[model samples]
Target: MTAPHVESDQVRTLFSRAMSEMYRAEVPQYGTLVELVDDTNRETLQRHNELRASLERSGDLDRLGVERHGAIRLGSAEELFNSRRVFAVMGMYPVGYYDLSVANVPVHATAFRPIADEALRRNPFRVFTSLLRLELIEDEALRSEAARILAARRIFTPRALELVGIFETEGGLTRQQAEEFVHEALETFRWHGDAKVSLDVYQKLHDAHRLIADVVSFKGPHINHLTPRTLDIDAVQAAMPKRGVTPKAVIEGPPRRNCAILLRQTSFKALDEPIIFTQANAGTHTARFGEIEQRGVALTPKGRALYDKLLGSVRRHVGAEGIGPNAGDYGAELAERFKAFPDDWAELRAQGLAFFRYSATPAGIEASKRRALPSTVDGLIAGGFLHADPIVYEDFLPVSAAGIFQSNLGTDEQQNYTGRSNRAAFEAALGAEVHDEFAMYAQAEQTSLEQALVRLGSPHVARKAIA
Candidate 1:
């Protein structure tokens, strides 16, 4: 008898859980953050029945606790290319390009995640992977040295490469093979205290940029941070101090809203961990941290444009300073500025400001059979024939990500880099094209509407003109 194939979703779920466990063990404070997020989510669900109900109706309730996203920075293209193959085993693909260089950070990134509705519902684990741009380094000698060191070291284990090849050729892994794959893949993200470079070289790279040293000195691209989703980021941010976790001064992204939009994120400061250099010298490195994110609806391009305009207005009012002495005032200004954006779900959909998944309600199914059924989407929704649930944004914002990095790395870590974007080079390194997140959101919304229509009745016959 042929062995039953384990779904990629299941493998992803297993690997995500294992990674959380490993990370929690490595960073005990992360466990506390997780518990706090869990408590916050529970409290939010209790306090907000409508939010809870909407989540239940949309299939987001089950995966809420399991959802997580981790980040890692790779020094070379070879490591990034191999990482794509490893992540494929878990059904994660690169989506959206983030050019941190524009934000004065030297990395360009993509979020590796599951795109399909079913795959996401199963386990929406993601990894924000970044490829270091050595060419951006001003010092040619330092750049060459960094490249040579990165080339000399192999981030992946021999077994992991073997398994990636096996999975690629065979299309899937058996249960045993998958278990082994998880173990080996985990090694790539595991922290190594022993640095590959001497203290002088590390200092040189560190002088260039802390992140550059972080990417080059390490044996592998250690998972820098793992983020757990929270229902209320403000609550968590307020409560982090009480829990002994020091959250960044201001929450990154849009201010709190009745109907959230895009992603709001905050994190405790990166920990200063001790490491041994190649010469048996000891020093400290700062990278790993615990992060919490509260996701909101995926906005359409128009919505995003409005959001960007309003955010810029807030910054203009508040100045270049972010989240410090003026954080409280900045937040108030943000809330005031965002008043221009719609807070109601119906309004958002009507304005084409956000993407939403449409589902046939019991009333809708009953109404579809009637001759007087509404034709337009808005009409059907108004007539209680359809329910539109906001499609949760499953990606990261470049500005928010850069802000988080800056907050952790330090306020002074900012450096001027002229190269704004290199998506072609990033893709060449990643070994595949990054999927368009906006298109993905649009397709999902369309698919959900089509499915709802089909469920109500035949496409041609169901509700003479349903959107």
Candidate 2:
């Protein structure tokens, strides 16, 4: 007898339910984490009038809600684009660009970055999508073979397609229809059918499929990870190991010197599971629990500068060359100019110079450094760095993401020497184009500030600030 066919709506419902269930089952300590955040928020409100007032002014935690991060994978651009439509129906949008392909430790793949906190607060769900690079496959025969196999498979069911169509045609479903669709779509993804095979082989295939099905199975698109942010990432990191949850690394973000900024993250290593697969000879086999990897990346000033510079270059180059510039001429000129620079173009752009240059520090540089460190989150707030008002976190750290993925996977394999694909190839596969995460975060923050001003019956106050 064939297994029951699940609808897209059911798949969505089950996906959410299964994710919650899985978290509860695998890392029971996550329950503690959730409770801690709630307790901390409550205690903070009760103990500190200032904090309570600030939260009230900015929008209460109830309004912001609990932040969560999640992970998922897709098989192709079509799936990625279609999934974007589905997420839009639920009120989420693509925010940041992340390149994970260069992450060489263990988990190596490209993905999109974080969503703004406001967007997240409005709806905190964010998924990092990845696609395999067929261009990276050196062996043309293997690449072709894999591509053929992937083309024949269908990751999204008919129901998923229908649901996406509905969401696209109609911004969203009615309350009842929305609930039903969410339920089914979540379920379809979460349901694991019975397929007899060995544990070891099954794991290999699963890992391979994660990489293969993405690119091989329809031009490569898959949700790589779903991530949630917490103010206490450091606390979470410390607690995980104690609870038998082996994290790939410690929290990665700004230094622990007490500052509120873009992001910090850590994750438990991926868990191994047994599975069944068909052999080449039409024989059945089992796969054992294989390795899973994870890793983390912090955005140092240098790193952030690099990131910004790259973005600026892309924008400037795009504007100068136009959308459909001759690839050969454009690449050649850009390469030549880039090579002429001593530092990275992005870094140069960030430093307010076309070349490396730094003025000597004043005589009081040491005394300035010795000033009392900022003790509270509020103390660290500054108009320049922290913004006049609190800004929502946006953007993903690719290094951090690669850290998470690598910590859970097997050893990273060297790419074929004969073929190498760069960041552009990976971005193309994602389908839903990536944007600057920090910019998105800033926009959300500005929106909230305006909203707060309106709520306070002082629209002019916000207008003056903007002016």
User: RMSD to native for every prediction?
Assistant: 2.2, 13.2
Candidate 1 lowest-lDDT run of ten:
458-467
Instruction: Write down the lDDT of every candidate, Cα atoms only.
Output: 0.88, 0.42
For model 1, the stretches where C-alpha displacement exceeds 4 angstroms are: 316-329, 458-467
Error of 2 at 129 (Å): 1.2
Tens digits of per-residue lDDT, candidate 1, 1-467, equal 75666788988988999999999999999999999999999999999998998898889999999999999999889988988988999999999999988667899999999999989988999999999999889999999999999999888889988988888888888898888989988998998899999999999999999889999998999898889999999999999999888888789899898999999999999998999999899999998999999999999988989998998787667743364445558878988888889999988987889999888889878776775566676677888877899999999987788888888876556577736699999999988999999999988888788888777763543332212
List the candidates' TM-scores in order.
0.96, 0.61
The TM-score measured for candidate 1 stands at: 0.96
Over 1-467, each residue of candidate 2 has an lDDT whose tens digit, in order, gives 42333333333333445555555554454555455445444544577675455445444355333444566555445556566666655555665555555443212233332244433334344455554555455557656665555566556557756866776675555555666566555543442323333334334444543444223322123223334444445555555556555654334333332323345565554434322333422322111111111111223344457544543364355322212344224434444444423343233323322211111122222322554223321222221111132333334666555545544443344333222335454456545455654344334544654553333333344231121
Best by lDDT: 1
Local error of candidate 1 at 23, Å?
Answer: 0.6
Poorly placed runs, candidate 2 (over 4 Å): 1-19, 22-56, 63-65, 105-119, 191-228, 279-303, 306-387, 412-432, 442-467
Give me the candidate number with maximum TM-score. Answer: 1
